[model samples]
Target: MESNLINKDEEVIRRSKTEIVLKLLEYLKPYKLKSFIVILLMIIVMICGIINPLLLEIAIDNYVVNKNVEGLMIIGAALVIINLIAWILSKIRWTMITSVTNNILVNIRHQLYSHIQTLSFDFFDSRPVGKILARVVGDVNALKNLFSQSIQSFIPQLLNLVCVAVIMFILNFKLALACTILLPILGIAMFYIEIHSRRRWEVYRNKRSNLNGFTHEDFSGIKVVQGFAREKETEKNFKAMVKELGDAFIKAVKLNDFFWPLVELSWGAGTLVVFFVGYKLITNNEIKIGTLIAFLMYVGMFWRPIMNLSNFYNTLITNFSAADRIFDILDVKPVIKNSKNAKNIGKIHGTVEFKNVSFSYDDNTEVLKNVSFKVNKGERIALVGPTGAGKSTIISLLSRFYDPTSGEILIDGKNIKYVDLESLRSQMGIMLQDTFLFSTTIMENIRYGRLDASDEEVIAAAKAVNAHDFIMKLEKGYHTEVNERGSRLSLGQRQLVSFARALLANPRILILDEATSNIDTETEKLVQSGIEKLLYSRTSFVVAHRLSTIRDCDKIMVIDNGRIAELGNHDELIRKKGIYYDLYMTQYKFLNE
Candidate 1:
């Protein structure tokens, strides 16, 4: 039963490989003319190669034995010319094929990256950055040799092999048959080698991905690791990952190393058999000395192609595994896609409504229940909830990051699902607890919110967020380079910059998700007026860690267990003495005491 199950799985894998190859061929359609020219050149090159051996036989029989120097020189010169033409054709074929393959690679990589961008957040949430990078970079690179060189090499070798086999039989049937006695044995060895090597190659690729993931994760968390003084433990873990990767590579290489020796064994055995048989035929006067010599050359031609084929087969199996991985990512259709009838909504008035909304990451577990809420145009709404009470989920839903499981969210009476994603997102600005800044000048980071913003406008936005003073204090002012993720800046400084970015966007709807969590008391106080100014005339949802920040908001929603436990202004909620009042008292107990 187990064997049957494994056989079925292997059958499925074989079918998948066939489909992937077919899909990849679609990318080759544009290069058909060039590919056809390459095929023609290979055919001419193979003809040239075959004629060389026949010319040698003629020179020996008609020129050399008769001691005719003139005839020898003529045939020798012809041989050199034929080889030169073949070399030129082969070089041209390589150039043409390489050009086609490079374009195909670019197309494939572009398609993969574009598709990944369309995928929803859940896709990224489930996979690590390194794994995605491995598929995009390493796996795509592995297909380079397969596409550019494999067709030219494999087809020419196969033609040579077949042509030699036919010529040998026509020259001497018995000798040809004798030489091929070990062919079946060679084929069997190659088959089993591919089967085992494929499994090993898969293991090797998986280990490589794991190693990439580990390295990226460790480097990304280097600060935390050093702060906890876990450098020794980190080193030990890294060593273990490297050892596993090394072992997997060695195992795969060991399997591959067996292929060349196997080819050599078959070649040597075939040559010995042909030599013995051809010598007997020559002595018996059944075939001439020239024919015997030609037969020997034909044996080499046959075995050489087989040897080349064995190497090609090794490359094919390894790259096929890589191709399989790349196609796996391509096959994952984005779960979220706009419907055919979806309309591109124009500028929204920002009257947001969630009607009987419910959400779940997975089917079995619910994160938010039938929650409903409304935010009038330009009203400031604050959502106060404990960790995991679905506060962030609400913000994500509002932005249409993830669609509600069973309800509709409308902006100005228009279902957001119908809105063009770009048009919808363009009018909303978001600032999260973790502010991400690229490695660029401070001016560029602020201008990111509005790419077309003038330098003066960027400085104005920065000034509005109280970020311009610190930016100017730097040696280069707005031009000062902030390293990766703005590592050079203090946490409060990063948040201030992020706030400026959002403010500059001038979004009708703004979301501040614990945006001030990292700001010190003094910094928060300094930026409070700037924050109030930015929030003016914007429909805003502030997920506040410091409840005092939302005291003057139009409404304060105290969420508990994904439900609205209390909903009113801060003063109204405090008078009601419910969940809001309790949370407000507990979180502010120190200040009150």
Candidate 2:
């Protein structure tokens, strides 16, 4: 699946740079007034910069040459005032840009997370959790400088460049032409550098994402690693991944580093040409000493913005891949979203029917093949099957996690696909094999089943599931906080808490997919009593390996190879001595031994 996902990523149509820039600019629409203000301040700062060299020329030629101390002092004071104003404006612009950039990032992250939640289970099944997190956290963050710096540096530097060029031309056209003669060569160098650097940065981003995926998977299964004493092996693998990432970074940086030096070289060569030409002009009396000095200052100002622009361009290329990745997720229309005319199904009567349902995660293999089943208002069904035998796929289909590739699923006579997803899911409760709990007080964890449930209701549900005794025995009772995934709790305890949470929801339909596999026989019996009471009048589905637990269910389904091999009540199936009978007899004999 990881390899398939990587292939799909590689095949993604890369958006043009202009498209990305245009999309980024769309984020600024909401802050138009603030952006305008920022731009206005930048222009003011650039104007101040352009005036400084002229003031220097006045002080040098009109005051110093004439020995006019008072005039020189006035020009000196004006330069200070202009620079001080520019500094103040620059600081304000920085603050505004930072705030705007942060808000845009927040909006983007929120949208990405919300869209991910709406995607089909297949989307998650194909990708690692760490890779998704990388897009949400790392990729989104990479765009931070692109937003802030584009405004902070790009705009101001561009305006300063144009203004300085105009001032230099006004002072002396011949020298101005000499100062800019190397720009064409610089542009050509940058063009080649950008072409190479962009590809390297894209490679670097992919390597970083791979590292993130491995790190997340490694830590998630850290206990398993230690249990098998594979810590050293994992450490070796981790170092290899880190080295790969480091190598990719070095390759990218080697190319990116060329931008600055190339700009510097152009600046140095341009300054020398200006000096040579200005000397010739001075000797011919075509330009005054003050004018030549002012022209030199303008030349420095001119190249400074070019260097700044180059840095901004470098930032754009480096992070544009991240921007493309972010947009890729945003561009994916959720495969499991509500239809335009879909409406709420309101409260359902727990009648579920899968008519000739079939599904496949990909194009090649079908997980469920034309399997049909029906559960009346209050019938309890037990599904018994081997691993990967489509038992879980049946439940997932009923929940509408993924729509069938063929046929239709109806709940209370309405097609589930036409109903509002939230309304459809609200009436059903599911508990899976791998139980998970949030890092919070046990009381809060139970209350998550029904957010508005009272403390009394939460406690009652916990008591019903036989979890209250173990919970109360803790140091802080129900208020005790658990670690991530409730790692601090025993497996049986976690399953019990999950069971209680499901019970608290008061769902009309309940699913228990190996919900009691972790509990011992003694606890299972105790929990079974509560389960019997809770199962009264509520339609429930149980998938368990323990035949004893399903012996009394209304019906037992033996699913094999994506098809139902046997379906009957315990006594009825036992009389026929079929698949259910064989399974039950084997487990029954094992338990006796």
Candidate 3:
């Protein structure tokens, strides 16, 4: 059963590859002028190439055999001039092809970039940055080669073969037909080479993507790897990855080793057949010596282009392997799309309700079972729970990061699904557990919350979050560089800056997910005070490990195993002596210590 399923999947993948290739061909539509110019050059070059060897035949029969040196010299000069023209035309054709392919690739990359940005968080969550980068840069270049070199190289060769075949028939029909008879042998060999090489190249491309993803994941978690003393292990893993890549490449080359030999054998066989038959015809005096020599020359010329066309086909297949990987991402339709009727959340009342909501990350188990809650405007709700208690899941639902599998979540009496995602997210400010900062200045990072915000507004927002004093002390003050992920600054300092950014957003709903847990006490105090001021007249959800932060909250809910086990005021719940009470006592003691 598993083997059958695997075969079916392979068939599906092959079919999809064909579809993607057809779709990518459409990107060439806009550059009609360049395509036409390249094609025109190709025809001219092929015609000159076909006529080239005939010039030699003329020199041999009419000039050399007749003992006319002046006639030979004139014919030889004409050949030189035609060859020169062919070279120039070929150069221009290649130039146009390269120019067209590059512009098409640029358009593809731009559209891919814009589409990715429009995608929801789930799209990014499931894909790595390096994998996506490889698609845009690596895969794009692969397609570029397909358009620029493969198309340009193959077309001229194909046209040359057709023209040569026609001329050969006109000269001697029997030998021309006999020479092409070995196509079956070449076809069989090409089939095996193509199939075998494609398999190896598929592995090569996939391994490359995996290696890219590993690099991205490792670099992003370098601190963790170093702190855990896993550098040697990482090195070992990286070596294994590269070795696998090398093996795949070697496999491809080994298969390629036979490709040229097989093609040459076919060409040699055809040449021998043509030679023997033409010799017989000459001996019988059925064809002129000049015509026979010219026919042989044309056949030889035809062989080269035919061989090149096959090789170009091979290159196209391999490059398409890479292009297929890229187009796969481009072809993926985002699961979440905006509704035509969805209205922008210009202003929200902040009245939220989770009504009989249930959700599951997987089919086998439920994460949030029948969660029910409501919070009025200006209310601060604190969620407390042991790890894996669905506390974070609840927040995800509230923020519309994921919709509930069952039931509805409402913001100001409107179903969240019906609201514009961009507008909805903009109205909600989040201080995530892992705050991300770009390799930019402190002022810019803060101003990210409001792009049009001026320097004065940024300063005020930083001060409001008690981040101003520390930021001002830095070497560049507001212009201080916060390296990637704020690696240059201490954890507490980064959190302070993140807090200021959130404050600047001034969201109708604010969330702090252990927003103060990583900061020092001094900074914690500053953050706590900042929270107090920022939450004023705004709906807030605080997810804290330390119960001390929620004492003054309007309400507290203790989640257990994806269900709300208790809900009440902190003091009220403590008196009741239930789960919330027990959790508070244990966590509060740890905080106090």
Best by lDDT: 2
Q: TM-score per candidate, in order?
A: 0.94, 0.96, 0.91
The alpha-carbon lDDT assigned to residue 43 of candidate 3 equals 89
Residue-level lDDT of model 1, residues 72-162, one tens digit each, is 9999999999999999998998889889989989998999999889988877876677777877999888888777756676777888789
Could you tally the backbone clashes for each prediction? 0, 0, 0
Question: Candidates 1 and 2: which is better by TM-score?
Answer: 2
Give residue 194's lDDT in candidate 2 (0 to 100). 87
At residue 335, candidate 2 shows an lDDT of 81
- TM-score of candidate 1 versus the correct structure, residues matched by position: 0.94
What is the descending lDDT order? Answer: 2, 1, 3
lDDT, model 3, position 457: 96
Q: After superposition, how far is residue 160 of candidate 1 from its true place, in Å?
A: 2.8
Worst 10 residues of 3 by lDDT: 1-10
Error of 2 at 564 (Å): 2.4
Candidate 3 segments whose C-alpha is farther than 4 A from its true place: 1-12, 59-81, 117-132
On TM-score, the stronger of 1 and 3 is 1
